[model samples]
Target: MLTINNLSVHYGGIHALKGINLEVPQNKIVTLIGANGAGKSSTLKSIMGLAKASGGSIKFNGEDIVNKPTTNMVSKGLVLVPEGRRVFSNLTVEENLFLGAYLRKNKEEITKDLNWVYELFPRLKERVWQKAGTLSGGEQQMLAVGRALMSKPKLLMMDEPSLGLAPLIVKDIFGIIKEIHRNGMTILLIEQNAKAALEVADYGYVLETGSITLEGPGKELMVNDEVQKAYLGEHK
Candidate 1:
């Protein structure tokens, strides 16, 4: 449902992204797997208008959204759960979630979405009145995803959801990701954990030094020699 073509981004003469092209089809999870400085996050940021695109087009369901404001993008059903779970530290869990629906006017629908988030994340419900900063890392990440879901996204873009967590927690997070996708949310995932990312995605792309190096079905890329050598820690 989202298409990025010839996308480029520059940070004061430093070329961060170079004419990269990718797509996320409806109801599918598309992942971008890469190492640090590979422009994976920049691609998501540019799509959300957090990073200025120097050239090319970002289209959402056929219309060009390259020049749209971040708020406009969110209102348009394109939402990003950024690399770090940037939750409102001082706000209560409920308050933080409510902020996601700041642009909406329908009280009943907002309440319905809130309950849906709570059902998907029972921990957030238990800590509804607790300050977001007090939650554990896993809880905070759940809160981040829950908050994003409150916005009722058509396409959800998540950057590094598994970062800095215990292995068990990572598994839980990826499980939730799969659950989200199964429930019909289109996802564009950026992850350094290539193996886990590919396992959950329907399609995958490998980005290196600001350009796409490979693209294929997720399972195909998972078993690829180059992918195995570089990202999956396998040696022939």
Candidate 2:
């Protein structure tokens, strides 16, 4: 449902992304796995128009959206959860979720999605009135995902959903991602946790120094020698 071709991004003279070509099929989870400075997050940001693309195209469901403003992308059913789970700290969990649907005209649909979010994340429902900043790291991440779901997006781009959490919590988050995918949300996942990400992803891409180095079915990539050596911590 999303296609990025010959994508490149530069910060003044520093090149952050160099010719990243990737695609996420509809209703499937696709992961971009790489180490730090590999331009994984930059690819997601470029899709949301948060990062200015210096070259090439970003297409969402066949529409060119390379340089579309972030809000426009949101309106077009493309939303990013971002790397840090940047929730509104001072807002209550419910308020944060409400803000996510602010652009929608269909109040009933928003209410339905909110109920679904609550059902999917009972913790968020329990802390509905609590300030987002007061939630634990895991809870905050749930809130972030719940808030994004409130947007009712066709494609959800999440950058590092399990960045800094306990192993158990990371598992919980990935489980939720699988649940989200099962519910028919197309996902473009950027993660450093290659093993876990690939386990849940339908397809995977490996990026190095801003370019795609390998692409294949997730299971295939997980067992490949190069991927095992570079990402899976396995010796040849």
Candidate 3:
């Protein structure tokens, strides 16, 4: 559903991404797992047009999307949950969700999508009128994912959905990610938590220092000697 070719990004003199090629197929979960500073988030930012690409191209549904306005992205079926679950602090949960569907004029369909999001996250349902700023970190993350789903994206790119959460909450988040994929939402996941990301991904890429060093089936990468040693904390 999404294709990236020879993608590169730079910040001043720092090269954040280095000629990385990646793809996300329809109805599948693809993950990029790496350490901090590996440029995983940069890839997502580039796709969203939040970050400029120094070189290469990004395509969505076979059309070149490089350098398009971020506003144009949602209409073209692209959405990002973004890093850090950046929810609107003063907005009610319900209001935050509605903002996601602001571009759509069909009220009935928006309501239906809202109901689906609430069902997917019963916690958000319980806090419908509550302000997002008061929510816990895990709940905020759920709200971020829920808000993105409100856009009805064809491909969802999430940046570190599991970051800084408790282990149980991280597990819950990954479970929901799998459920979303099972429901036929294509996902491009960027995760520093390699084990959780790979466990649920159909395919995985190992990125290091702005370049992808390995790509394989998620399970295969999970067992790769280098992946084991580096990300999974295993030694042979």
Candidate 4:
């Protein structure tokens, strides 16, 4: 569904990403995991065109999207629910959701997506009239994901969907992610929660200091000696 080749990014003198070559197959959940400064988020931002890439290419659905404007990417069905749950503070939950479908021309299609969002997160449904600022962190996270889904993206790129949520809430969110994948939407997930992310991912990449150091099947990554020691926290 997505392919990135020799992707590199720089911020002033800092190399945020170094020649990242990666591929995400159709209709599957692919995750990139690493420590705090491992360029995981930078890769996602590059895909969204939020961050300018110094070099390389990003392709989606067989078309080259490298250097495409973020708005153009949205129009082309690539949406990013960024790291933080950045919902509109003053807007009602329903209003926030409505804005997500702004790119959709059909009212009926927008309404259908709204209904699906509510079904996916009943709490959002219950608080439809409430202001998004009033939602708890976990609830807001769901709202963020719901808002992204409102864009009706074919490939949803989620960055740290479980950043600061409670364990139970993380489980709920991951379950929703799995459900979304089951329903045929592809996902490119960048997460720090390696354990949970790998559990649901079909494939995984281990990124360190702006480069991919390991790549394998998700289950294999879970048990790799170096991966287990550096990422999984295994003593052996």
lDDT of each: 0.94, 0.92, 0.94, 0.93
Question: Distance from true position, residue 150, model 1, in Å?
Answer: 0.4
TM-score of 4: 0.98
Residue-wise C-alpha lDDT for candidate 2, range 80-138, written one tens digit per residue: 89888999999999999999998998988989999999998999999999999999999
Residue 147 in candidate 1, Cα distance off native in Å: 0.4
Lowest lDDT sum, 10 consecutive residues, model 1, at: 227-236
**Model 3 agreement with the true structure over 101-211: per-residue lDDT tens digits:** 978889999999999999999999999999999999999999999999999999999999999999999999999998898899999999989999999999999999999
Off by over 4 Å in 4: none
RMSD of each: 0.8, 0.9, 0.8, 0.9
Q: Candidate 4 has which clashing residue pairs, if any?
A: none
**In candidate 3, residue 223 scores what lDDT?**
90
Give the per-residue Cα lDDT of candidate 3 at 125: 99
**Candidate 4, 4: how far from true, in Å?**
0.2
TM-score of each: 0.98, 0.98, 0.98, 0.98
Angstrom error of the Cα, residue 156, model 4: value is 0.5
- Give the runs in model 2 whose Cα sits over 4 Å from its true position: none
lDDT tens per residue, model 4, 1-236: 89999999999999999999999999989999999999999999899998999999998988999888899999999989989988998999999998888788999999999999999999999999999999999999999999999999989999999999999999999999999999999999999999999999999999999999999999999888988888778864
TM-score for candidate 1, please give it.
0.98
The full ranking of all candidates by lDDT, starting with the best, is 1, 3, 4, 2
